[model samples]
Target: MNRKNFLSSLLTIGAAGPVLAAAATPNAVPSVSRNTAASSAALPTPLIIPPYLRPGDVIGITCPAGDITAKEILPATQLIESWGFRIKVGETVGKKDGVFGGTDDERAADFQQMLNDPELSAILCARGGYGAVHIIDRLDFSPLANRPKWIIGFSDVTVLLCHLHTNGNWASIHSKMCNSFPDDWAKAEAIQVECILSIRRALSGERMEYKVPPNVRNRNGRAEAALIGGNLKTIESLAGTRSDIDTAGKILFVEDTGEYLYSIDRMFWHLQRTGKLDRLAGLVVGGFKVKPDDPGEEFGQTVTDIVTARVKGYGYPVCFDFPVGHQKDNYALKYGIPHLLDVQEGAVTLTDTSVPAAATPSL
Candidate 1:
């Protein structure tokens, strides 16, 4: 079907209601009802971690969101290949249908193909713009249930990450995509180089840990639980959908770019009202590049003020200015995997506590 017709069909189904719309999709995974206020006890099944990549393992690159020319991903391919992994460029990489990488069907098919390809150890998103939600429900994740592979990217890809976590209990990488790759590696800033290299370390099965200077507003405490979250706006948008996250017993991290303080405050309020902030292992407030309020219309509160006001009653650790989000220092985070969040007056640290695949409990 053409894009226009497809969208119109969606609108018709949506008008009927979300349940009917989801039920109409043959391959759609049923949304699991969760207890948002569940205790912080360990889950019965540990998150499934896809096999770590090795020398010559194939990493597929597909454009599930926005358009990106083959020439643009050259730097990313060259760099990833340097890490001893082969690159399999998907058909949607250079294709364009309006601002999207391709038609929704095309992008979904490309990603589904990668997910089912046994040779592809990981699928790296070429970029994240505004189309991942358009194709998410259309793709079948049954293949991933049997042969899970690392799904990498952030921004719009947060929809995919959250869907994987909420529905399949699969672990994924939340990090920079192809668009963030530096064209000239030699001239890249120190932070850029470090962030890019962190992706390699994650896919190679290295235990991940990071430390950042503490903000005066940080609440000192420690908690260990599965870490989950991404762009705040994206998280808020997924509410009431199949991809909506369950934060009952997890360390949640949120970040965003180019939003007004009031908008940010509203999103936080949504979280609180929806019981997302009622119980948590901790909260990591990542880099938020708030847009300046218009003249004569300033929002009286800062990001920290807005956050602390909401979670003041919760005893879990709350740290600000975390090094994750749309910034040069944005580090890779393992979604669905258990992590240790330590907040102290002097510093904050997040550590991956994933066990060997053989030792991990299976679903």
Candidate 2:
């Protein structure tokens, strides 16, 4: 949808609240404070910042999601090794059982070993397709709690990120995985190279800051809160589960790929109804590769239209197209770390406030 038409739809939707209200399902779960004193509370005091990678530290590559051949991960391994870190290829790599990296038991055991390995400074998923949820309940996270390390990836890997946040209060990396690595680094597009390098920057503990051109649909404001989010459909599916994220007083960002507009709207409705959208410090809309509607069945609403409708009464900054998702522009984001989001008329900036300004490298 074009900008002019999208703005018009937003105004119309704003005036017709009853129509949208009638379409929403009642929230089934009671809202709980994410900061509750319970031991299992989502946000524990002094959130665990996993020890960052240092020269010669080992980074284990495991396929906790879809199966990836050894040949496919060579580019990623080579690139990471060049950054001064060692690589330990997990047994799950190249192992396959249907679409999964391996049988559930195998995948779980491989990941459990990585979590307990004292030599490893971080774990990177080979790729994200599906299957993390299958083994989420099977593996133990206590080893990780005792020795925290960065867990990285997006898409299906959102399961691990959210589970670590809610259950262990440990921070993780949300960025591109092995399959995204370019075969020829010398000839790769600049943006693709930059996106991949972002993983290294994140792992080495350089503070992150991202800026994008301002969108006309963006809500102007500023907020400083822990940034939390990943794939939208995955977050919605996790509702009421132990891995479910607690977004109250945090900046929530979401992106997805290959979904119809109606489905996106439904997912946002799920967020709104569950009170996830009620108290957010801000909202960020990332790369959504929407599917075209079938003939005569068009949803007739843009992502901006749907998001604006759901957050109508809330007064938090909302920025669309913030460059994170299943696309090449996706940058590394630290889940559970505090960030400052500023939406202005000229640009939108997301700054990682958990680190000192002197530690942030130039963009």
Candidate 3:
């Protein structure tokens, strides 16, 4: 199956089971606390900043999902190495087990080793296709919780980030992976440049802010809360699992690609029904690409319409077309860190509050 279909299919099956009940279980609930309270919790200190990559520091690249060739990652590896860091490719990079880069056990083992390694400054996924869900439950994140290294990627990697953020209270990047990097950095688009620079800023503990164009459906207001959410399909797949997000008083940013409008609607309804939409500080709707209706069927509402309708009564600020998701302009955002979202007439600004002014450079 193609990447999108594979994600959808796996998530839909998960939806069929006792998702609501499973999500509501006490152990599965996220610890949605304020700065002080969250710090007090036994949970791995929230927003734990991993050690930044320095010259000679090694970064381990592992394929926790879809199979990828060394050639596909060479460009990204070279770019990173040129930045003065070392690259340690995992065994799963070129290995294929059906649709996945490796079998569930194999992928888990590779990732576990990286998590346990002290020499690696970060572990980035080779790509996000589908297998993470199969191995999410098998992998132990306790080592990561202690070391708190940067874990990067999006789409299916949402499983890993969510696990670290919720269960481990660690900060992780929701950004491009090895597969997204262009071979020639000079040929990259403006948005691609933004994405790459943002990744660097995030790794270096730099704060980021976005000046986004306003949308008619956007709610005019402001909010400050921890950022969370990623691929809607993957988030849906995690509804009942341990990785499911608890969005209470948090800014939720969601984006998806290649799904039917009806399916998107259903997913939103599920989020609302499960209390995922309630009491949020704000919402950011990123790129919803190629959302076609099924044959002879129409959902009759744009994604903005669905979102605005769902959050109509709430006063929280809402912004649309924020440069994120499958698009090249997919700005890197820090999950589990506090941020400020100011939605005003004609424009919106999103600022990361966790990092200091001196630390956050313009990306």
Candidate 4:
């Protein structure tokens, strides 16, 4: 979609309602929040973030993707602090009017400033609501190229990840940030601590293996591949553009939140139709918060059902309910790390390839 239509779509989706969509099945009726298990008997381990985080690292929080709920800022900062890093809230952090976050110029500026800031160890987004596409076109990554650090967020920020992976960093994370972090950090401080520490490990080149919540039913094939993906909409948007992800032979992890089951199907359909979904050696679905249009048809085919329909015959292992989306218990995954995914005997273990420490940032 061109920038004009992209902007229009944002307004349209928002004017309709806040996102709370779920996949609906014709006969199944159940609470939407109930997590659906992956239909595949086993799954693979997700890629780990490069461990570059340290206690005193200065992290920059910017609003490049979407407008954050203004009220959530202070508390979000507290959550970042709870993880032990100080945050520099950008001038555009809370930029939002109706849906576009900030004026294209404003959002672009926030990203530009952070990319240029040498002191900021990483620039994390405040949210990913239908805006990054607008600003990405205007960005000049000279600063980012000079001082390479983590640029984190999911959903819309996937655009940034696509560009960064191809042109600059050779690494980044399609993980959580901003409003998404607080709820987790405030409660599971240690988990938050581990997450930060884990990212640090990935970045600093001290890679061993990160945690993957044990899955009883995982894809049994053991293979190594790169970690890549964010919201389905964002990834799908990359279709046809130069930044379209090359999923061929990679472990593709996909997740999204607040999408209608049909919309979810449509996005994946784009992937499938475009041959993007066909190349993956394995597929790991992140948390899906699917809502049905008709209350009577709650599990309208279910998230798993749609997933199975799209991926079942592809010959690659498919795992569902894996952590990588807009869920509270999502995992922090490195977008470019290579690791082993073993779904054997109903267990998924993501083992690192045992490479030397990750290269230090150029600047």
Q: Best candidate per TM-score, number?
A: 2
Model 1 whole-model lDDT (C-alpha atoms): 0.82
Per-candidate RMSD vs. true structure? 8.2, 12.8, 8.6, 13.0
lDDT of each: 0.82, 0.81, 0.76, 0.61
Candidate 4 local Cα displacement, residue 181, angstroms: 3.3
TM-score of each: 0.87, 0.88, 0.86, 0.74
Q: Residue by residue across 1-363, what tens digits does model 1's lDDT show?
A: 111121111111121222212222222222221223334444443355677778998999999999999999999999999999999999998899999999998998999899889788899999988899998777776665445579999999999999877765668999999999999988999999999999998898778888889899999988777889999999999999988998877889999999999999999999999999988878999999999999999999999999999999888889999999999999998888878788998778888767444443221
Q: Model 1: residues >4 Å from true position, as ranges?
A: 1-44, 355-363
Q: After superposition, how far is residue 20 of candidate 2 from its true place, in Å?
A: 40
Error of 2 at 123 (Å): 0.5
- Model 2 misplaced regions, further than 4 Å: 1-42
Q: Hey, what RMSD does candidate 4 come out at?
A: 13.0
Q: Which ten residues in a row have the lowest lDDT in candidate 1?
A: 6-15
Which stretch of 10 consecutive residues in model 2 shows the poorest summed lDDT?
A: 6-15
Candidate 1, residue 241: Cα displacement in angstroms equals 0.8
Model 1 RMSD vs true structure? 8.2
In order of TM-score, best first, we have 2, 1, 3, 4
